[model samples]
Target: MIGLCLGLAGLVWAQVPTPAFTLAWDHTIEKIRWEEDYRVTPQGLLLGEARVRGSGAGMEIPEGAELKDGSWRYHRTLPPLQPLRVGRTPEAGDYQLCFDEQCHVLSEWLGPPTAEQPALELWSCAQVE
Candidate 1:
């Protein structure tokens, strides 16, 4: 099984079971929802798809994106990423990790934030122990 590790400052804070998952959040400026789907692979994490509720400053729809169900959807052909960093602030609310038809706030999984650890990091790891 593949393990998705959520960490702070190079320390693993929590491990979530995953073959695939979606990371979603609202744009800090526009408040529009953005979602990215990823799959855990042996090499790393592979991005499967992305969608956005609407476009705004710094939220441009991709050239080949399709508008469907009030959102712009697109697929990317980028290489697998080893570690993904997500910055968080006390005021910006929480990031959602969705899978198995349910969503959970990141902060809820890892507990409260700290003054030093301002960002959450995600990476593929060995089976959760």
Candidate 2:
């Protein structure tokens, strides 16, 4: 009975999802760059540990934006979950953000797009097996 219970417990533990993905970026000070780590979670892309030259000297975690490799790729996942991707934004929009050999620009469609909010979303998500 004890062995059976242990086997069942192990099965449950194996099924529990763990943090298997990480995205990192850099912020520079002179020639020195600070590195930040972001963990991909089902709830969202969460800001994790950081190594900085000084307090608040690292890159600001893009809130609600998917952290792609070194750039923030827009996401289409349901709110609060940002899936990271690797690529550049389309080359046809007035909005653009670029820095440190990386960028996150005007891409993806979100909604009907009021003058305030646009109608687009970007980024990629995992597929089911």
Candidate 3:
């Protein structure tokens, strides 16, 4: 099994079990729901699928995406991302990180964002060395 690393202000803050996980958030501009699924790989983090409920500004439905059951679903062939950054700001609200059949608020894991900490970094623990 591999572990997922969470970093704050360039330092490792916490780690979580991450064979696969889903991140859900509401679009800041459209106020619509969006979700993405990712899996940990030796190369990095691989995005498997993305889904969004409705579309609006900055939320263009990707080409080849299918509208099914009121949501647009699609997949991308992007390379494994070494580290994914999640920003924290009043305007952007919070993110829901889920795995192991449970969901947690970003703040619950990283605590409230402060002036000094503007974002959280996510990467596979294999890179810790």
Candidate 4:
């Protein structure tokens, strides 16, 4: 009986989910900017710039702009190549930044949503800051 109980306990412990950490954005929407420097095999390097915006407001990230009301979401298809470098902020919540092998910032918001019914949404590229 003791061995059976210990075995069951071990099984339950294995079923537990991994703990997740929250990530905070340093700059606000106004200050936030997405700059991608691409490097080609033959060529050297290319710089590209894009603006980040909210889904509802559609307001562009200005200088020193902060995220008003948003949560970090993740996507399975587009996984980030490296772990996210999180900062200090209260808006942060339970989430994990997904990355790929290359260690590129593939997706910041790539995890399950808070609510189950509404369904989780995943945004990519400039959309994620």
- Which model scores highest in lDDT? 1
Task: Give candidate 4 regions above 4 Å deviation.
Answer: 1-18, 28-76, 83-129
Cα-based RMSD of candidate 4: 17.0
Residue range 1-129, candidate 2, lDDT tens digits: 000000121221111122332322232233333343444354544545433332344445445655445544433333432432222222222222222445332232121214443222222223223
Query: Candidate 3 on 65-127: residue-level lDDT in tens?
Result: 999988899999988877888887766888888999988987887877665667778887753
For each candidate, the alpha-carbon lDDT, in order, equals 0.86, 0.31, 0.83, 0.24
> What is the lDDT for 76 in model 2?
32
Candidate 2 global CA lDDT score: 0.31
Which ranges of candidate 2 are over 4 A from the true structure?
Answer: 1-29, 54-124
lDDT of 3 at 90: 60
The global Cα lDDT (0 to 1) of model 3 is 0.83
Report RMSD (Å) for each prediction in the order shown. 1.4, 15.5, 2.4, 17.0
Please list the residue runs of candidate 1 whose C-alpha ends up more than 4 Å from where it truly belongs after superposition: 113-115
Which residue window of length 10 is worst by lDDT in model 4?
1-10
8-89: candidate 4 lDDT, tens digit per residue: 2122111111121112222433433223222111121122222233333344345544443342222223233221122322
Full candidate order by lDDT, most accurate first: 1, 3, 2, 4
For candidate 1, write residues 72-127 as lDDT tens digits: 99999988887888888766667999989998988778866555667888888887
Residue range with the least summed lDDT across 10 consecutive positions in model 3: 120-129
